[model samples]
Target: MEEVRVKLPFNLAAGETEYRSGVWQGLVLKWQKEHLLLELPAEADSISSAVYGGGMGRLKRAVNQFVSRDYECSNPVRDMEAKLVEWGYPLEGCAGLMTAVPLEHAAVAEEDTGSAGIFCCVTAAAGNAARAGSQRSVLAAYRPGTINIMLAIDGWLSPSAMVNAVMTATEAKAAALADLGISDAENGLPATGTTTDAVVLAVSGSRRYAAEHVYAGTATDLGGAIGRLVYSTVTASLRSVKAAEAERK
Candidate 1:
């Protein structure tokens, strides 16, 4: 297994080859022949931004601060995003960004190969939800929650497959929250029903990767990691908020 060391939050003149997928939030996935590797800021736990307008430009700066500029990496995930934010920046909704990288790449399944891979991130916030059985009224304006997924697979997946991945991730996400019981949630219904909104992201794969694009079981490599990470990230986000509320009491 070839291991590549990466310095995060810096200018990227080109892309790396260990990864079969594209870039998400400046992080790219690299397959070490067996396991997975992602070039990310070690301090990146949860990403939050208030400057909704120039988000792209600002997101880079924010990531740079945590991964590049800042040298301190001792902060805990529970509240690292806010603590890392430079003074004077607006603190709005947290992106709840999370990435998955196996500590041991040697454990990756031998069957997981070729374009059958992914590099991804997910942000989840389920503040707003609609009832599963109830009809939604477009006229009845309501604030929607943030539930999103970003995926960069190794090959050129058909439109249907892309949608399939999204659906798969969605189901996985809902299950994640449902597992928590979200006892404090007031969003419409309970398990088997209420689901949060989401956004899926991906980039074009390499020509080598484009040769074969097949999405089988998401239990290994990209799919499995994504499902688990999304669940953890969202759960962690909810935990922080819930914990804060308890403190207020």
Candidate 2:
């Protein structure tokens, strides 16, 4: 049940448009047997320079401040799953641990108003299933007021299974800020990257049954798309497990 963290780098040396086109790489978490592991890719690379103005400006600063020289990051879904598979770990659902921190202003009065980081984290957990396979459960975690809306959904529903549902929920929240005519990438935070845009991070956990398995998930798409795939995979696996269990009964 131990957690192992590994820093991953891209094969920029292998490709021509490595840095310019962006490559996938990141930090990984694995268990004792090394069978299951989770990957956490920094959100710094998820910036869409075109869609969100000032995204690149924020991205550059974030990379320099939070990421290492070798860090080749790209969103955090597929990369996370890839890291697990590469390590030979089975897929699981979300872990149900989501939190958001608000942003703040450093120059304001000392006692008047501090900032909340304004962040959200989703956790997915996977474990052995009935047919000697693995199953996952996903949970969405967000900030107050808005977070409850996401949690109001069925408790047993995996965040992966309801990808659109989750994104719709998040976009709805972001829309409010957008309506305020605020740029998603540069609000007013003192943080390294674009202070305006909100940061949403999702994490998946893989647990190895024994101590001899290898770690494999990789962070590929940091966009909302991968979230759909993760959910689809888990939902399919769960169905297969249920069918097998029924046969055994």
Candidate 3:
């Protein structure tokens, strides 16, 4: 069977892929393969489950770049640190996520309300998809297939609100997988997400917006937008992979 390349919704440049929204700028850098880079308008408050910098922090003191790299190495933390040095991005200021999925299959969705704008990017590979509670305990190892998400919002959010946003986004991801009938290969149950799924949520923390979001639940406007964007982007990314696989058959 011939290999079929999946087409992205947007164009990819020869050396670097660039995308811009009202709030942020993104570039898909070409190293040995491709990785995603997001440049913020200013230092933003972020929360993530990334391998390199996986925690709640403020992207301050020249720390403003967020990256999602495609990695298959056993030593993700070390390899990721070395890659940052090689790429001339400081480890201090950058938050990173790793995945086995190729960046060419990445999907992006954006929504701009007059008050707040949201941009979401996702790279997903679900071969090891699993429900959260269905899997048995095992030693930790680097899993190749995973779903990685990066979301940037051009508005102010409290710290609690940022965490709320993560919860909302996660629910949307599970909903996307369930809606697509993606089952856990191990348990034969509906997959909530992959074993190694990670997400990063960043907010501008700008005071320009009249309302400071203290809550982001499904009932709130911000949470509703986050859910919709994540759901659509995850669905689109997986569908692209499925389409490519079908072509190979």
Candidate 4:
């Protein structure tokens, strides 16, 4: 399946709602008394553009502007986490969530033929929408690469710890992107405002596969913890298989 890059809505200021749409479904990135919803068409196949039916060019421009200007520094995780801590999150004990998805899985999706590819199965809804509000403002402070980590945290962690989890993931993801020559982690990543905290990273041209680690808040939060455990276990299993394949080579 083709992996397409998408831009989120850009006008989500304080108290303003932003809406984004795709071909199959819609999403509302709800904020403080605001909505960032995505528009979707009935026929998924009709989507020629990226998320929001917008072209990739527009997406690219938005990315460059958001990351280049807003996220000016090449390294901003430290400052971002500092802000989070100031906001009352005990980030010292925060753990890293890490996992890798192999190209073999992509092949499996292709072979299935009846299913929507692996991208669709594990992908998040997205479109162009800017982050607003104090909570969102904290999120927008980081680069796209780091923001994606936060996005994963929002999915994996409970609402109570979502903010802190995102901070931790942001640190990890920034390190990964820097190692991969992605220039600036802030602008290099791809995200959509399809949901409250849904985002997908742009991993083309550098890595052979995409990795995501969902920090599901804490052990007490069963819902988030289960998400973390399932993803971690599956990824570890895949990594072992991948390592074995490498040894055969």
Candidate 5:
């Protein structure tokens, strides 16, 4: 069967590439391995489920850098800290996410609506994919596979709206997995996502736009954009990984 390419509403940048969406510009770098660093035009209000700086807070000290690194280590926290030191980045001001999926398989999607813009980047590996709430006789040990999502917006989002966005993004991810027919190995149930999945959301909080989003549910425009961007990005990232695997075989 011929593979149908997923059409993104915006450009999809992959590998070592530089991209700009609205007020944000970022670099997809290849160090010892591939990683992505998105530098905001200014400090932005953000929320994350990352290991470093994994909470809702206003980014300070011009440390508006959001990073997604390809990592494989037993001591993730300590190794991630050392990686920042080796890269000359201060741990105090940056938000970081790690995944075993190589950055080469990373996918990016961007959308601009004149009033607000959204950007999403994803790295996905579903080897340990599982459905939420599945009954397991024994908990599995930590593994290297994960689905990491990094999202950015060029407009303002209320704190509550930020949390809403996270929910929306997560729902979209599960929907993508379902559509792909992914199943949990342990229970044979439809997989919702990998156990180690993580997400980071950042908003520019720019008043340059007249609208300030107070809600990011699926019913809202911001939420709609978030849903489409995340859904498409995750689907595309996973497809790319599958294609790579097929090519290797």
Candidate 6:
């Protein structure tokens, strides 16, 4: 069973330059059964370009500190600033939404593989786009693409499923981009969507933050939510950018 009863959409902001520039930054804590786990975006698989890897690295370290230090940061704002600065992409304010997810079981689309848990958040930035498998030279210097999903699930997931999750999320994002005609002028891919878009995820042993925290639906529900949320949020961000550009024009 999944844990539907949750206290989520909580806020998590840290850094000298508030992590509140764009979307809301949140830190969701799901207290349930079993163990402890920490997840961050996969480098090279996400928006973690050579230039941005340091940020990811710092994020990982921060998450660890937040966790090992009892899963709470004394100063999250500084933590966020450190993470971003390490990646040389520090901004004035950044934000994210933290929420509890229902992933106690494998998604419904496929048969029951195993049980799982989820907590995820996303931030959108479609400033640039690049093709998959393209060389680093193609990426413009200083310009960062949009979209970064931070997903952390509890319990073990087959390695294949884990990889599939990233691709699936990317595909859904691409579909949303296509629907909105958000592609590049050169190759027609999403302007903000790059082959190297970032999807950070982590899986670990289950740990109960509270008592009796099981979700109601299967992991499929969670998957759908990720796609739906990403689509709407990213599209909205894209619109915001377009509107601003038009206004400037």
Q: Among these predicted structures, which one has the highest lDDT?
A: 3
Encode model 2's per-residue lDDT on 1-249: one tens digit a residue.
112111111222443211110112343322212111223343232222111121222121111011121334343344435544554434432211111111100000001001101112121111211111122232242111111111111011123433433454344333323333323222232111111123222322221111211211122122232222223322332333345457889
Clash statistics: count for each candidate: 1, 50, 1, 25, 0, 37
Query: How far in Å is the alpha carbon of 86 misplaced in model 6?
Result: 8.3
lDDT of 1 by residue, 1-249 (tens): 322111221112343334322333345444332212334322222222221211211121121111221223343233335643533333332222221221111111111245544444433344443344554544232122244344444445555555556656666667766786642244345532234343433434445453533452375344554555455555554554455457889
| Alpha carbon lDDT at 4, candidate 2 | 15
RMSD of each: 12.9, 23.2, 5.9, 18.9, 5.0, 13.0
Candidate 1 whole-model C-alpha lDDT, 0 to 1:
0.38
Worst window of 10 by summed lDDT in candidate 2: 104-113
Off by over 4 Å in 3: 1-10, 13-16, 23-33, 60-73, 137-139
| TM-scores for all predictions | 0.46, 0.22, 0.85, 0.21, 0.83, 0.46
Off by over 4 Å in 5: 1-16, 22-34, 60-74, 137-145
Best by TM-score: 3
Question: Per-residue lDDT of 1-249 in model 4, one digit per residue for the tens?
Answer: 232232222333443334332211232222211111112121111101111222111111111001222435444445434443454434432211111222122110111112111111121111222222213333333233212221211112223333333333333333322333333223434322211222221111111123222232333332233233223322332334446567989
Instruction: After superposing candidate 4 on the true structure, give the runs of residues whose Cα lies further than 4 Å from its correct spot.
Output: 1-101, 105-161, 164-216, 222-227, 237-241
| lDDT: worst 10-residue window of model 1 | 102-111
Candidate 4 backbone clash number? 25
lDDT by residue for model 3 (72-163), tens: 55777787777778777767757767776756677877766555778888878688788887755543776443788888888888899999
Give the TM-score (vs. native) of candidate 3. 0.85
Q: Candidate 1: which stretches are off by over 4 Å?
A: 1-117, 134-139, 142-144, 183-188, 191-196, 208-211, 216-222
> By lDDT, is 3 or 6 better?
3
